[model samples]
Target: MFKTHFHSFAIALLLALPVAVSAQDQKPEAPYNAQLIVRQPEIGQGSPSFVPSPQVRGMKALSDGKVYLVSTDNKQLLAYQGNRLAWKADVVGSCPTVVGPRKISKVLLGPKTILVTVGERTFAEVDTATGKVKVADGQKG
Candidate 1:
């Protein structure tokens, strides 16, 4: 009898998993007060050198308290819970230099997915949870 009850309970949990996951996939609602601030670069001593601040290529705040950020200098997608860094995923084929046109230019947040666009043509669909690239460079997954 205990084994039968345990099996039924496990089945019920499995059925509810999708619902929980789907709810977590939704984007954050309006009145989002999270501001993206790119501070001005500070110059060092000796000779004036230009330091690059955090330039937001794309940013998205989810309803599940996850804030995703992509900087112009770094071609990696960063996930943050509050001020702490949660995870980061590199944008496929992206270079570290901020000079070229190959950097991530936009980030679109969908109901169930996040899409990162490079330049004007390449699009990478990234997973919200694991930061994995599901589809890249317009390739179907």
Candidate 2:
């Protein structure tokens, strides 16, 4: 009787273990065209609000739940953990445009960095944690 009961309990525990582990191992949803609030007042209005100018120029999500992006108007590189903003930096020399020939094309994820590209060239190498941007030669796409 003792042996049978022990075997049944062990089997049940093993079957339920996977579900429990998977639930805890799930990652947060990656950021994608998420509307982020800007502190800048639009047209010198009452208060700072979400504006259409500083849109998400490019975004890249990592497997470790980090999302990196570039702003449309100022070309600011931003990093996010889960839904919270981690850090931000100015992407110097980045040519960002909404309706022009030279525009921000895409964002790529590196080993520990994020690459901001325009047209068919990479322009910035941003650190994943500190949001430090190192200007790259616009050679590789």
Each candidate's lDDT (Cα)?
0.59, 0.57
* Model 2 misplaced regions, further than 4 Å: 1-60, 93-103, 119-122, 138-141
lDDT of 2 by residue, 82-109 (tens): 6788998766454342232344455556
Candidate 1: list runs displaced more than 4 Å.
Answer: 1-60, 72-74, 94-100, 138-141
**Per-residue lDDT for 1-141 in model 1, tens only?**
999999999999999999999999987643223445222223332321111235343344434456676654646777766666777888746432233356676666654567776655677778877877777754332
Pick the TM-score winner: 1
* TM-score, per-candidate, Cα-based: 0.51, 0.45
Top lDDT prediction, candidate number: 1
Q: Give the TM-score comparing model 2 with the true structure, all chains together.
A: 0.45
